[model samples]
Target chain A: MEEKLLSGAELVIRGLEHLKVSTIFGVPGGAILPAYDPLYDSPIRHILARHEQGSGHMAEGYAQATGELGVVIATSGPGATNLITSLNNALMDSTPLLAITGQVATEAIGNDAFQEAYTVGLTMAATKHNYLITDASEIPQVLLEAKHIATTGRPGPVLVDIPKDILNQKAKWIEPKLVDLPGYKPTLDANPKMIQQAVNLIKDSKKPLLYVGGGIIHSKANIELFDLAQKFNIPVVTTLMGRGAFPDGHELCLGMPGMHGNYTATTSIQNSDLLIAIGVRFDDRVTANPKFFAQNAKVIHADIDPAEIGKVRDAEVPIVGDAKSVIKGLIDKLGDTKLETSNWIQEINEMRESYPLTFTQDEDGPLKVPYVLEELQKMSEDDSIVVSGVGQHQMWISLHWKFTKPNTWLNSGGLGTMGYSLPAAIGAKAAYPDRQVLSLDGDGCFQMTCQELITASTENIPLKIVVFNNGNHGMVRQWQKIFYKNRFSASELTHHTPDYVKLAEAMGAVGLRMEQKSEVKDVFEKMLEINDKPVLVDCVVDPDDMVFPMVPAGGSNDVIILNEEDLKKI
Target chain B: MSERILSVLVEDKPGVLARISSTISRRGFNINSLSVGPTNIDGRSKMTIVTELESVEQVKKQLNKLINVIKIVELDPDNTIESEVLLMKVSINKDSQTSVIEKANLSGAKSVDVGQDYAVFELTGTSKELKKFENLMKPFGIIEMIRGGRIAIQSNL
Candidate 1:
């Protein structure tokens, strides 16, 4: 028999436990202190993050690494406001995240009360859906709805803001079996007419290309995209977020295209006769100049969001439906279409060979970021997840790490939020204890959420955080060196970092530092051997390193700054 | 192509017009036309959007997923009655004020005020009626026009 007595906070915590949430990242404050009081005795582990944003990112990382929704709790006002960046990141990346924040009491709302912010309005754009729970009785339903919206179709973050009074009020906790919202229904089928139209266009084109994005991963349609690509002998180019959909090792995988993408990736799109875009919003980053993005290609943009179908470029055929369904339909209809085995493939191959991702390591200057990623990749499992903090390290991980599954590679794609990796790694490890969860972070991002390392150590979630230390926001410094005429504006950060080994020991975990290129392989081997606790590897890297082949944001995709030009020649 | 109904909730702010219309332009989903109005609450409004999508099933499903949209539902076209409201401000010669007022009343519109040289007329009904009123006042030289967004509700038995 289910008991019916619990405060809103208890209901929320109980519901989370029922939903199998073992860990929650948060910071206690005035409005949310009530919820914290009850959490002390709960089975759910509450991690006290130094900042609310760190907690938000931890939730995001966990959700992105594991398919399970990431849960974060924050107090009202600035705590809630700080979460905006992480929320924005989740929204942009379509990660499954659930963020619950304490709200000022109903009486104090709109009265400009302390620690009060318009969280609902602030998070509306960044969440798939959000609710402000004013009634304590509605807590169960709201929690259910929040998780449902978050994990359902093209997964994304959702928020539920409960006022302090509501959290304090006792209510009958009715754990409903179903959420019946008449207004919410997600479709997973392609529009037949649009599919037919797309099929017809693909059928007519000589050189068709499948431009895949993160949607393929979101829909778990990598097999389908790969099948369609091979079915039609089409080359596949992924956006930055869409990496890992097709292995770079595969000949069919053309590599990432757009600003900062490989030449072949961008050129393939330009030269292709027909472009079939799946589950990707053609952001300005992808299409620096829409006019030239697919100049010679007839575009057929397929996305679940109707508004994004042709938002950036003209679509010869726009299909608004789930990526998996649409791609399946296309594959079904692609029978007997003649394969165009043209030199377009040759051009792509030539570019890939000409501009491959590389880093020199001949007893080289500082530690190499790529070498660190390569070592980690070998040590990690195919199913293990890697989340990245924003900056040079983020770019390097996306470039060098070989991921094999959906949610295996998580990064703040849209918002580019820094300090996201560490906590997210902790969350991911907690969510899926069986899998290895690691945050490949930069020093800049590591410091941003390093306080959560203590959380990781205390919770005993065996998360591995490999911090690529360059002593600066390496990406911004690269930008300054290239674009801003080397005028570094607050791009450098310095604080006496506690000896990380002692720090991890202090926090009840393992910590190792790698100063030389040779030191990394041995240190990483040793770290992997000791899986008893969380580990942090402070990897010293080249300070002036830049993520090369970057077609400056808003610049032409075909135009790239070669790594040689940026590093060796310059 | 099939048709679908969508309910879009937007921040009731200026230039939301440009955002909505521009979205339509980008998507190229033919708008059969839509009706909108303010809701019971302030600073929030709803739109009853009717559009010809390639697939009714797909459109209905996708409409529910938009992050900016607060809520969406397919109105049973068989049972729901929809309407649009329109408002206009016209500057007419002082001598033609009486004629304009008479014309306004004939079009089921009320000339709510008489200014030094202009009159603001308000009308609530179908878009056809509003268009008719606009055409009737065309000779008087319309100075400004405002059309409320689309809103709809199911008629009770």
Candidate 2:
């Protein structure tokens, strides 16, 4: 076959096509102009975000929605620097994200030329791996290797920074070779001895709780996890990142267990005799106080990343393998037997009934945020994808929303980056055009990335955005009210808040504002009916309505306050 | 606190050392001494690090998590041949040259060069022995000195 020459810019698009990337999210600039030129004729759909951060988060959203590699592109210097927060967010959450940034010419890399940034150095610590492609021939291999690294073995964000000169240089077209990374081998199967030990622990315990995490969704092991739970008859409690890992409506589902978790979930783990922690790193939020967390439980951790096995709390039986494989191993070892935990389940149900998630609203008062989420959840389809911005609204969505499917609930759990939902919802909508994609955001979070609404309208993505407008940073204000003598300080946003309804209308989307509780259902139904363009609902919620069942920072799970009266006692 | 010696084999790539050291420091582990150099194998290097063992397990896991690190083995100080090289330039006078040479000889050191005002001596020993030798050379008005960080190899026996 006669060899054909192609520019590095063309190779980039070809590389993405080879990876089956149908869409990308980014904004182009000077150093990245060459790459954008080729993109003009490419089949890949490019989402031009208002900010680099938005693009990075949109990539994350796309990855989370569909278990595939998400790609983001940006220019050098300030543009690449703007992606730091989202990159860190993806890294911390184990999301498979690939960010490609344009750099100055190879000759001007270290000379600090226009739009020049040391992207490799800046992203080294924040990414799973990073590369600086100075040669055009390295483009094919680098992109393929980056995809491999980003999607395999405890996935995380990877970065590739290509200089402008390299993008312009012509190179012979060659097929991408398989990555030969000897040092990058990840353990994918649990050892037989470790599996036997975990099985022994599971069999011996009268009370065993399956603590699941985002790794279930990342590895697409929810079916395996669900099967294991069913076969073993073990109660399951997911972390915030693992919201939809197991069916929330299932009998064994104890809901989320963390700082803002359900009382039953938190207390059940505290009282359980064995904790089968699957694909979860015992983060500070999950383990409010590590010393007291699961004090009565012996841990058997199964995760792909060995480093996370005992990073926070020691695991008695550590199985370093993929979640699906380990769960299958456990099932195989156990045979056709289920552990007996009738008394434990009865006790957990009692706790759940005793301290259920509840809120109150007056006949003629500001709409409660929880009520809005509950109504929204009821109105949405079963497979609807809900992406949330970080704040009290996120907590409310996690607490009140009924997530019946895995990978349906998306939020910034680890980094807790605000301004995540607007662009993320667009990405999710683009990925799954038929599915209902909604962005449940807070007013404070909405203001940060609301500019992306223009992209949503222009791209013809019909994303439903619901802003829980409490006129304040509700989480910070709640913390201040509880911990800082009620001094609001910089938490208030009422003084300079945008008119979201008008703003959404100006951005060429249907806007609806609901101030009264009676109007919420009607307005939400109307918003959901707008299928041609995006819809925004500015819901006026009570500013003082705080997330309850709160476990103060560094406080033990036993110290969780269920309501305002419990808060006073505490 | 327990003192641990960790020997690491890594790809000879730029920023590998920086990545390892920074990761160690970021995790709040104090690197007492670190030495890095090429191994006999091409495109590979060895690093010897001495650090406190308060969070040693976490530190080890973090180190192994780095992509450049090929292998890591914890060497027991009692079962390893630990050695460090020291070079010292001692100020010499008519009365002090003979005494300095005698002291250097007692410490199993050799005079590498002799000058009018000063003399340079080279020594190789365990870290503790080097510390003692440094103290001995300190009284002789040592003008310039540098000690190579500790490196170790497992003893056959």
Candidate 3:
């Protein structure tokens, strides 16, 4: 067979196709034009985003929804720089993303030519690994290796910066080869000793609580986790990122635990005798004050990344392996030995009954965000995806919405990036066209990336964006009110707020506004009925409403504030 | 704070040093000294770093988390043969030349070059011995001095 010559640009597209990349989200510019020209002929569908950041986040949303590697491309300098936040978000959340940026011509790189940037240097810390391809011949191998690195072992964002000259240069395509990474092997199976130690802990503990995180969804270990939880008769408390990992409606579900989490979940963790921390990093949000967090509990931590095993709280039994494999090992090791925890379950249920998540609503007063989310949850199908931006509305969705499937609830749990819900919903909707996609966003968050709605409208992605309009950065305002002598500086957006309904209409989408409780169910139903175009609902929620049961910043989990009186006492 | 030495094996690639150093600094660990060179393995380099042991667990976990880092082994000073190389050009007068050469030879230093005004001597020893040698040479008006960071190998014997 004759060796066919292909340009570096064509090889990039070919590499993506070989990796089975069905879609990519990116924007085109001068330095990246060579690659974009060939993209026109590629089989992969390209989603043109209004901003580079939006494209990066859309890629994340796609990855989060589909459990596939999301790809994003951008030009050099500003284009690459714009992706820093999105990359950092993906890094913190362990989203599988591959970002390709175009550099200036190889000769012009160090000379600071037009649109040139040190993209590799910029993205080094934010990526799992990064590459600067100096030669055209290295394209195919580098791309394949980059994909492998991005999606494997603690999945994260990876960047490949190709110079313009390299993209235009011709190179002979060899058959795809295995990635040459000796230092990058991740342990996929838990060690037998560690698994046995964990099993012993499980068997001995009178009170065992399962603390699950996003890694369960990443590794698709929900079934194994559920099996372990049920067979051992242990109650489970999920982190914010772990919301959909276990069915929220399950009898053993203690709901999300941490800041803005339910009372039962946080208290149960604090009082448990043993904590089986699966796929969780013991983030400060979950741990609150490390000094007092799960102080009574002996931890058995299982994760694929060894770095997370003892990074925060020390684990008595540390298992470094894939979540699914480790959980499977635990299940196999137990061998039908049912641990007794009936009293613990009864105590947890009492806590759940005593401190159930609740809110007050007046018949004619402003609508509550939680009420809207609860109504939305009731209206949507069980498998519908709910993507949320950061703030009070995010907490509301996490608290009120019932997630029955894994990978169906996407949020910026680690980075807490605002304006994530809109573009993310677009990507999720694009990935699963038949499934309903909802963006539970705040007014402040909605304004940040409202421009991406134009892309949603133009691309015909029917995402239902429900703006929880509290007329301010609700979380910041709540914090200021509690901690900063009520000095609401630059937090309120009442006077300068744009009419989201009109804005959504301007972007060629159906716009609806609901200020009363009566309109909530009808508007949500109407929004769901519109399958031809995207819809934005400006839900006027009470501005004074705060996410309760918050463990104040730097405060211990035992110091949770359930109401204004609790704040006053503090 | 207790001082410790860490031997790290890393992929010999561009920007790895920066990656490791930045991660260390960002995590608030002050690196006292770091040295990097190619090892016996192909496409692999060894980095010997000395730092305080206040956050050894965090530092080790963070360093090990990096994809480029192949392995990390903490060398116990009590069980390892650690050495650092130092080169110094000392100002030499007739009065000080004989004394400096005598002290250098006693300290296992070899004269690399001798000039009209100064003589360059190369010394390799433990960090403590090198420090003592440095102090001894300082009185002779050292013109230039450079010391490599410590490197270690396990002593099976």
Please report the candidate that would top DockQ against the real structure.
3
Candidate 1 lDDT by residue in tens digits, A124-159: 666777888878888887788788878877678898
Worst 10 residues of 3 chain B by lDDT: B52-61
Question: Any runs in candidate 1 off by more than 4 Å, and if so which?
Answer: A1-5, A17-22, A33-45, A175-180, A336-338, A494-508, A564-570, B1-157
Q: What is the per-residue lDDT of model 3 for residues B8-108, given as tens digits with 9 covering 90 to 100?
A: 99999888999899888778887788999999989899999888887666778788877789888888878889889999999998888888898998999
* Tens digits of per-residue lDDT for model 3, A464-521: 9998888889999999989898899999897235888888999999999999999988
Clashing pairs in 2: none
**Residue by residue across A1-570, what tens digits does model 2's lDDT show?**
778888999999988888889999999998888999989999999999989998999999999899889999999999999998889999999999999999999999789898888888888778888888978888888899999999999999999999999999999767889856756788998899999999999999999999999989888889989999887789999999998899998999999888999889999999999999998999998899899999999999999998898888889999999999999899999998767888988988898888888988788977888887887788888999999999788988898898888879999999999998888888899899998999999988998989999999998999899988889999999999999999999999982358888999999898899988789889989988989999999888899998988999999998889888788766
Judge candidate 3 at residue B38 and give its lDDT: 97
For model 2, what is the alpha-carbon lDDT of residue B118?
Answer: 94
**Segments of candidate 2 deviating more than 4 angstroms:** B113-116
Rank the models by TM-score, top first.
2, 3, 1
A best-first ranking of the candidates according to their DockQ comes to: 3, 2, 1
**Model 3: which docking level applies?**
medium
User: How high is the lDDT of residue A14 in model 1?
Assistant: 79
Q: Which of candidates 2 and 3 reaches a greater DockQ?
A: 3
